[model samples]
Target: MKKVLSIVLALAMCLSLAACAQNPKESTEPSDSVKPTEEAGIYTPGTYTATARGHEDGVQVTVTVDANSITDVTLDVSKETESIGGAAADKLKSQIMDAQSAEIDGVSGATETSNAVKMALQDCLNQAMGVSSDEKTPVADGTYSGTAPSFGLTSQMTCEVTFEGGKMTDIQVTEESDSATGEWFASAQELFIPRVLESQSLAVDAITGATTSSNGIRNCVAAAIDAAGGDSSQWYTEIPKKTDTVKLEGYDVIVVGMGGSGVLSYCAAAEQGATVFGIEAAGKIGGDSVCTYGPMAINSQYLKDLYNNGEDYINADDVYNTWMEYVGSDEKADVIHEAVYNSGSALDYYVDNFGFEFEGMGLLGSFVVPEWTKLWCVYSADDDNTSWNILGPNKTFQFTRALETANAMNEKNEYMTELTATSLIFDDDGKVIGVNAQYYDGTTYEIYGKTVILATGGFLGNDDMMNEYLGSTVSTIGDTVNDGTGIQMGISAGGATYMMGTLPMVHISQVPHLIRTDDLTADQKAILTALALTTDQKMITTEGNVWGNENQSGTEDEGITVEIVYAPDYMYYVVYSQEDIDNIRTNGLTEAQANATSQFLSQGGTLPAAGTPVEDIDQILQVGEEYQNVIKADSIADLAAAIGCDESNLTEALGGVDTTYYAVICDSYAYATVGGLDVDVNMNVLREDGTPIENLFAVGQDSEGVCNADGKAYTPWGGQAQSWTFVSGQIAGTQAAAVAAAAE
Candidate 1:
């Protein structure tokens, strides 16, 4: 009887729709005698709420369903990335309503959040259909393959899962990208993959500094679980953490970081017979250093013999003079002198004793002046590629070699990963002693040592500290785990800071959440890259104002860095028209004007050749729209409305918009923070009153400001920061080792 009534109701509804269409002006409201059918539609009319795992936390979806259609949908993706996932709410909601079902093409760039919304909405719709909620899906005993977005939003990390007797037996990552630091990704694979299998859960903590890769692996497993007919959410079982305390003592020197600087410090201290304890907040040893190309060297024997026939490639005297001139002051002249003169010698010492090697000499991406000396040298890698393999992945193995060499020098020398230094330990006279740290699993550690070196890379990862010091925050490509604990520890020990508000190392610009090369073909990626970099058309900031030299806040007179750093939201948009698209399809991109290279976007593809027409121009635009990196409209008014800006301002910026228009977004990313704790020539932390903290030292980004000025650009050389690590780390380690010996 129920089935017969459902069929009759469906036939009557079709007839009523036909009658309404025939009589256009007829009232469609039901009469009093024709009562509306209750509980007869496919779906039980009600709102349903469901939750699914997002990039970081649970994404809640509330869906309203009427008797026959999806009435409305809403999402709460607050825990996702603000500019990426969080920005896709409206689009996702609109997609759900338009499809009238959970079947929807998700937004690009925010793939994780989009997938979560789809899964949660599907659950809600299933509830509306009166599906049994008490029953759980059984996992089929078979192997399955799945994928998820990894480091790059558009890149995929694939994994194969084996299921036996309704339990996951093994998982093997079939493919992964090295866009995230290679060492960090390896660390994630080494630690994260096994924990999931051991716990039989997806709630394991992500490896520090390798969160993206860890999440990628977890999501891949979750996808495999779903494919095997099991509820992925059921595996998000919480794991308990132990709250215990541990104490470690008898170390002569403690290094509170394991990146380029901290590793060098440990090696230098260990060479001096000082027992060293190294603490790293990340899962791996190399932090931002793993992603860097190389470091600056003056007249290192390798560069001198290979490039300039053993004499000096460049004079040290000129470097020191130019360095002082760049800062426009002699405030930290002593430290600057040490940085310039000792850079080569420090690198030589590491090469001779610590097994470090530099293959060739070249210029860095962020050089100050074209005519200046090519002081930077590339770190040697296994395979030779462009620029002496310095920019390749194998260069990170050099740090590994250094750490191994250091450990062999002293049996007591040790390093711990996933341990973060919380604060400095002080003695009765308020003198710095050791450090207080916390393990990732909630264990407390109190480590004592005679001297401490602060080298936690800068505080670019700390939002509050960035706001407190630099007054603004930018997208960082550096390790987000390198908070300001080292600098704060220095300050707690009466150490002052130098140029705390200096500009960051902002060198690269691309579309927000850059789509990886694997996601787009060479031609499509070339077109997108061209759209982002083309200055042929008028460009405007997020606020609808024309972007020009007048908007630059950089202290540098001329450079792309200044323009990008000062742009609104650190981004701008290039407006194109239907005519522009037609031109691109017919003729070609303004190849010369559009060839500005963004290393991140051009990783695995080449830009279209000049005058080579891009036939897939429209397809590329569609992709840009999907990624929310492009805005398309039919008129100037629509463009303004879409961009959320005033039409008048946009008109003034672009003169006028005619026909359909597309606005392509361009965003900037930074490497790390520039300024940090003040230090003396010997790399000892200095108090506000110009006195040195006897047992405290700062290096790398923590003391980088000693060579830079606030409000001005970083010492425009790319390898300068890496060079400082060697110089400052060596000086600090040697000085601290001497202090420890004297105390004994």
Candidate 2:
């Protein structure tokens, strides 16, 4: 139960307790279509006893009503669970007054409770709305147990209904999912006894979305009626409201993940002057921002800010244009326009006060953006050279600046702890208040806070996750260290999911060894070795047939593709030699043929590995069977054939290779996949019906990745590790803060 509440609250996207413009016929025909024969105005609203309980304890409620609305409501049961039900109770009363049943909005903290209450009320309303109360047969009115399915998931509950002389005079306590709202729902039993006794029959409502609890409660009543063997249910009845609240321990805000987005959210909240606690999922503090290589793409106004002391900085428009040119995709949303138009001052504020870096050299200024995005810069391997450090002549400084800003915020907020937030806890009112952290030693530490921002780096950090969701049967080409634990936990909890397929992390490294031992195709191996000589180039698709567009579904697998880095031999199991790789890095090789001569000496030993002399290759230490996945070819087409690519495109791209861009490509790094997730602009995780989860918010990778297109791509986009981590985190933290503050 502890695990469910904490984890489920964060990942609460599965439930759709609220309905908007829904087709009522989807459930049942509306009873309201029939006309009331006995002047409906003369009917006096009656009280209906109700019992709602968790699997453990049950609560009783005495609900009193007049006419069509509830007048007085009281909870006669519930002890330990009362504190968490305030919001649910308030919303329940409000809903009964203005709206009756399934037509109401979902309660945040008391989601299940509100739904159950609505259903209980609907049971009575359905009867009152019926044209002939006597014609309404008793479909259910007893102590019965059943399971209700919602969001493709199911929950179980128990119900007890009572009927005496035809009308329902009493209701008994039963089970509910919201262990907290037990008293409020159960209290209806007492106040409703008189009405149930007087009426000939009564109709009741079922909980909205919580059909299980609703059915359980009604079944309890039904069982009581069946025990009496009477046809009951024809009077008006209502459920009580929740009015108490439960608050968590210290701190106003808790931010999950610590990469760029997490940092930004923390900084923003701290800037707004709130006491905040920053939580991370990994053992380290830096999510993905710290590992970035270059400045992020910015708009023109940002460029204007850096011009003040122009010794070095970047231009925002350039970032946009460069991205469009390189990625050759049209998805960029005119960041230049927004930055140039509305974000000038904001850009200046970030740059001047936060020390945000801006790069303007190399393609850093003229760089092209990929059609896809994950959250990092795509270029800048030259930074390792003497010419590209933060202050170097060729280097522009945006990445370091952002990190500086985050650290500064941390410094200012001494109370903040960088704990990994494994789970989130929400009060019954449907507001987030606390979180759980699992330490490296496998111990879990609980943190109670007002709000939390998820900035955990994307799923790229976890090896297991990569294989589970991504293609990791082979070595992962990107940052092997990126695992994305925070994102996984966040998603599993209902925080919502997004952005997983950004830059494709080539999954196999020692693939060749897997041939007989692990299973790989011949062509899959040769292409890998052939491409091994270039920069960080990943074979994402084979002629665009298998993965149409870019793995939007992450379902299809065409021919094999490889993610090869530009080492002496492309990023491969074995480069002939470090010097040979250096030669490719320096652009000194005469021809592709010339390069193949010593391929054997460059990397792994013989066939037991191919291309190299067995003795010379064997000299290098090796373990399992021969390296089998490596590829070798004299021409691009041959190479293309081996790697499962468009032979024609490879031939063309190789004919007149751009030495400047292709030179010395280092390996790539992947933080998480950013693809499809159902969400709204407010960063709210929504049901297919478009209603928000009360306390649920998502930030960082799992949440962000879902919104982006599948097979998203990023190039050395700085913070590629935590690209969306910064922005998405800001949205979650701020909103979570708003919800918490409102709850308080």
Candidate 3:
């Protein structure tokens, strides 16, 4: 009887619609039986509310329908991320109202939020239509395939999904090309795929730091679900409770962090017959140390071998003097001597004990004193792609060595990852005892040890700490995991801080020039085009000073560092001629430009054909022809007008470029920071009164005084910092173990 009634109602609605279409003018007239407040239609006039899950939380929506059409839609998006998900809700609400339908295009970069809105609207519409809430119409169980648009040069991300009993049974994402070298995609897949299969929903939270790749997988899965005709409302999954607990206890020494210093400390303690444990806040072990290219060493067997082979080698005395100069004369000579003298022995210990090897030695210096290359160090392993070697010159090679050391000591040492050390546990006497840690799943644990080593690295990842210590104008391009938790713990335990005013490694404008060409105007782009055609020109400041290679400067030296002069208005140019352009076309870009261009290309960014031997200059010119910053003009006055600069300034700065073309350049960026806990030569943390804290030690970036040897933190040479990481770790580890043994 109910089915018959539904059929009759449906027929009546169709007749009403036909009548309205036939007499549009009459339909607009007020009907006596219909309420004056409502539009003329067959829909039941009422308001309906529905809720749907979103990326981070839930979205509730209310809809008002007047007979035939939706009159209004209100969204409650209190649970969404303020910037991204909140903006999506605001924009999508207007779009849905304008279209007068629940189905609408999603906002780019906010796909999860947009889908939540759509699902909420669908629920409201179904309620208004008097659809049975429990109506279970199963989609045909089958395999479905779909693809999402690529982010870059990579292929469109494709997915194959299998449905069983109207539920998602399995999903397989194809190995597609990714400009991030598959890291982001791999992380997203590892985190998102399992959740999608369990909850059968595409509204899962995006991966914390890999949102782009997470969205790609979500879009692909949504496409497959649409193909399978699956009902999205039924795909909701219950969120799990966080009740998992892990307890660990009774160790002689506990090292907080599994970075270069942490791993070395653990190994050293274990070698001394002391039971040691290590913990890392990140899911993986390697911290910022994994990202280092190489370490600094002085008077090592590697350097001796190089010297014996008649290669340029630095003397120990020169290295010591240069370091002292870099640190300033008033710096602690004893600390400096300790690090310099033991650096070679530390390297030897690691090589002899862990089978670590050095490929060769190299130099790094500051731009203020370009001639002094006091920083020299051994690189690990060969650059050649060969068999699976434990260490290499690659930035991540140290991580490999650390992981190997951890594995080798698995019998005697225990380690846990994804556990954050929140605070230090102290006895009644104010002596350091252990740490208070919390797991990723909300479970807390108290880990105790006789001696505690703080190898938690620097606070580069904490923007508040960086702004407070390094100044607000400073920026960072370092590891995101070094949040200074260990430093905070040390300070809470009455440890003094040191070297808080050091200069972090910084460079100007490392991003590819052409990547931002979309912000340029046609005239400016044309200048860049002409400049790309030129060759054999070095990048220089407007004052004709060398702008490149500013890394060779001495400590605290004031000059035009690359980072200081990388402003867009500073206006740099590559002075070149048509003949140089022809030569470049025949021989390709200079080695420096080629290397830079190659790095940009590897990241899936487009570049001008200026580096290639092409006959048509149009192709090269067209590369950044749309960017406004690449200003070009036939005359100095026109060029000034294009760049919005004074003609006199332009004329004076670029006098020789009247018959030639010049291309504007910007800064390159790279960053690392120093400054941490105050420590003695034994790596024992010290109080504000200069008394050593009992059983407390700091190493690696956690030890603040390492880079402050000369009173200035802005030391030339990357090797000094790298070498200190290892040397401090060895010192802290050995001393910490001895302290633990003495206590026993």
lDDT of each: 0.76, 0.38, 0.59
Error of 3 at 461 (Å): 1.9
Look at candidate 2 and tell me the lDDT of residue 304. 32
Which ranking of candidates, highest TM-score first? 1, 3, 2
Q: Is candidate 1 or candidate 3 better by lDDT?
A: 1
- Give the clash count for each candidate: 0, 164, 26
TM-score per candidate: 0.83, 0.42, 0.65
Residues 1-744, candidate 3: write the lDDT tens digits: 011101111222222222222222234421334332334343456999987755545688899986677899998877664434665676778877886666566554344566667767766766665543444335568988756543322244677888898778888887454323322344467767887887666656555334445656666666666566544443444445466555566788899987778877777777677788888876555565544445666667655665436443456676677768766664467777877777777877777665566655534453454543544544553356342211223333445565466556646577777677888888898877888887655678788889999988777666578667765323233335567887888898889988876655554333123321122333333334334322346544444444344423342354434433232222345544445556666765554444343212133333343356535443444343322223345666665565455667666666546644434444333345577898888888889999998799988888855557422334554456667767887887788889888988
Clashing residue pairs in candidate 1, if any?
none
- Residues 316-365 of candidate 1 have per-residue lDDT tens digits of 89788988988889989999998888898999999988888766665443
- lDDT of each residue in 1-744, candidate 2, tens digit only: 121111111111111111111223232332323333333431246775554432112334455654444566554333212322432465456655664332455343333344345334433443332222234334344333222211111122334454433445444455433222111122233323333344432233232112223334433443344344332232223333333332336666666655556666666666655566666543234433433343333332545343434332444455445445533454434422332222234434445555654443233222233332311233232345443321122212343344455456544342222233556675686555677765422345666776555555455544456556554422222222234554544454454444354444332233222211111223323323333333233332333122222533222222223333221122222323333434433443334422331121122211222233223222111211113233344444555665556756654545433221111112222324443233454455555455665455555454544423344343333332233443454455567667667767
Candidate 2 lDDT = 0.38
Which of the numbered candidates is closest to the native, going by highest TM-score?
1
